[model samples]
Target: MVLPTRQNVEKVLEHFNRKDGVIVVKGKELRERDDTDVEVDFRQESSFYYLTGVAEPGFYVVIDVATKRIQLFAPPVNPDDVVWMGYPDSLETLQTKYDVDEALYTTDLDARLKEASAVYTIPHFNLTFKDEAIKSASTEDNDALYAAISEARIVKADWEIEVMRKANKISSDAHVKVMEAAKTGINEAELYAIFLNESNRNGAFFQSYMPIFGAGMNAATLHYNKNNATIENATDMILVDAGCEYNYYASDITRTFPVGGKFTEEAATIYSIVLDMQKACFAELKAGAKWEDIHTVALEVAAEGLIKTGIIVGEKQELLDKDVVAAFFPHGIGHMIGIDVHDVPKYCTSVERIDRPSYRYLRMRRTLAAGNVVTVEPGIYFCEFMIDPVVKAEETKKYINVDILNKYKSVGGVRIEDNLVVTEDGYVNLTTAPKEIAEIEALMAEASSKKRKLE
Candidate 1:
């Protein structure tokens, strides 16, 4: 269904807080492959999609902040292009399809811009036409508009939430597919193909981001997406971090499990600890809960788990204070998820990052509120690159038990992630992939049995 984007436009207008000027938004334009005529795949810019809900390229949205009128401008149809690319959507069709008040050709956009008291476009939006009425807005003005739009998106409308849920469902099922198909002797590339087939068969053509089909040591690399390794050990954990975008809304999910369908003793211990971290973070989630405080809950859980496992040798506070724990759980706990995976201001309260090594990548720094959708992804990685600096350091080396750390390093890394929509009381989980050890092992075993019977 076409999103009812007028309400989104209204929200942007309310946030812009100015009635005298027109807010201009540029949509994505069609492009071709470098040095070739082959057209590139088209994906609309998130902000433009939020405003117009028009996925086709070469579109523009002009919103009159005063009257709340939204007009969509479409690329003028060319008969020559139509001969190659079928008849384009007519102006009337564009109007009805996008549910815009007025639909005009690009010919009218310059005139509209020329007539505006001042044209305001969000950051990173380029305006090709020039007019005296287009007085240069200060950097702060553009940033303000960008921030205002981001604030509008921070709390999704009901329809937006539903779209995101649909995306999560597709992605969750895809993860299950990858899980059931994985086994020793299979290349990560094959499993990655399974994930793509699942998403495609379900009508989702694009993944929210690159899929990471990291096996064994590969999982320790946080941004690993090589997806090319072969699983030599059945018990080594494979981390699959992927999701698909549905109708512009996005879902981000991560799941890690053993290729053999049963986790090793060490694997289960680490996996359970990460799961506990997620649960603790969830308990702290709700309106008015501070983002960093929820993150702290994950860090605390990680510290306790590491100590229990004998990988670290210190009290939790001292370990956290000395940044020893950050080596294992280096990234931020989670971030806002929406049309764009890394949806911005990354914004909540205009607060800056804590800048400490532990809080360096905290994406959102504001207190949680109802209607906010976020991911609760807390992980523990054993990548030597991330850990050795601390081990080599004179101050932090005492906390890590090198012998014990090596014993579990083969487990590599484990990350558990889920999408959640915040409510007044708490959050509603949108991810449905089975994260429980028994559930995963059972499903994979069932799948393996079917394959054995077929063989």
Candidate 2:
């Protein structure tokens, strides 16, 4: 699986050379859940993985600036440990596998730091050796080191993009499988289980984040993950915002569909509008485009659609100027997606997040560039909490059509999200799940037909 090559380590070391410092990075360790004896499956920390690409716990990497040398310190295993956890690779095996200059036992890490003049390490809550290493040398916070890595990560290398493409393909296929199996009486948890099963069967070791399997009113909650509600086919819509990790890269996708295999009149109208809004945003994405501008375009498109459907009554431009669209689309349009789901933010040096209502929630505000991977998601929700309080306010009341809005208050929401990579001219969509209305209906119909034949 695509381990970071020597060239990747050299890139970070070059940044460290500017300050004449050495870098000390700690890998993640296996830990037990809260109070349980069971240990959670181990995953390498993202920053550490980006440099070393070693997945095992209890390891550290040191890159020396002056000498341009890299070394790995790994935990040594004894016969008893091997009896419990099976055979462990030798230091020579690790050095060859990870393509490092040398590998030594982690017990030597403390002594190794004594030779460094300046040291830098990324702050991590669970880091085992950060404090000790700092005390042993003239260490600093190293905000520059963090920024350097983050900036480098903004534009993915060809190999990184390839891994993300595979991740998106696996996630998209799993989403389709869940859509075909979804029905009226199934519990939200069952659908989540189906997604997990399919992802695991296809070789995804972990989900990028907790799956959002909301049905009906539950869909209105942005980060909902209870996944315990019953899906009412006659009235409810299923919104699954889930993705899987492949080779340390992440894919995030969201698809909203009718549980009854057909959208009701009101549901159809709202779904189509949300879909169009996403399309408008996609058209605006390209190298050199500001993320804020793309978001503003999405807001305009959604506002016009809401006005056409009688949900809001006002001039489209006036509604946008008043920031009234924030009530329906409360969150940012999307964010960068890669090693971390909400990948590194557009650092303050690039652009500070705007303070205005609709712009405040944006996660990335920098100009787009080629080789950058991002998710473009635009949605509209009838969230009672976010809408009702504003609706009660006298000054904001005139823009709403209360009668028409009430009809959809129970409709929950509609969101369509896809992963894409910026190209020289536009963007290439990595997600290939069927999104057209006819395509969704036909696939569900085929599944139903097969079920009937089996019975």
Using lDDT as the measure, the top candidate is: 1
Q: How well does model 2 score by local distance difference test?
A: 0.84
lDDT of 1 by residue, 138-249 (tens): 5677777888899888889999999999999999999999888888899999998988888888888998898888999999999999899889998889999999988888
Residue lDDT tens for model 2, 175-285: 998889888899999999998998898899799999999999899999999999988665688889999999889999999988877888898888888899899988989
- List TM-scores for all candidates, in order: 0.98, 0.94
Q: What's the distance in Å from true for residue 111, model 2? A: 2.5
Alpha-carbon error at 238 in model 1, in Å?
Answer: 0.1
- Residue 443 local lDDT, model 1: 96
TM-score of 1: 0.98
Over 4 Å off, model 1: 133-136, 347-349
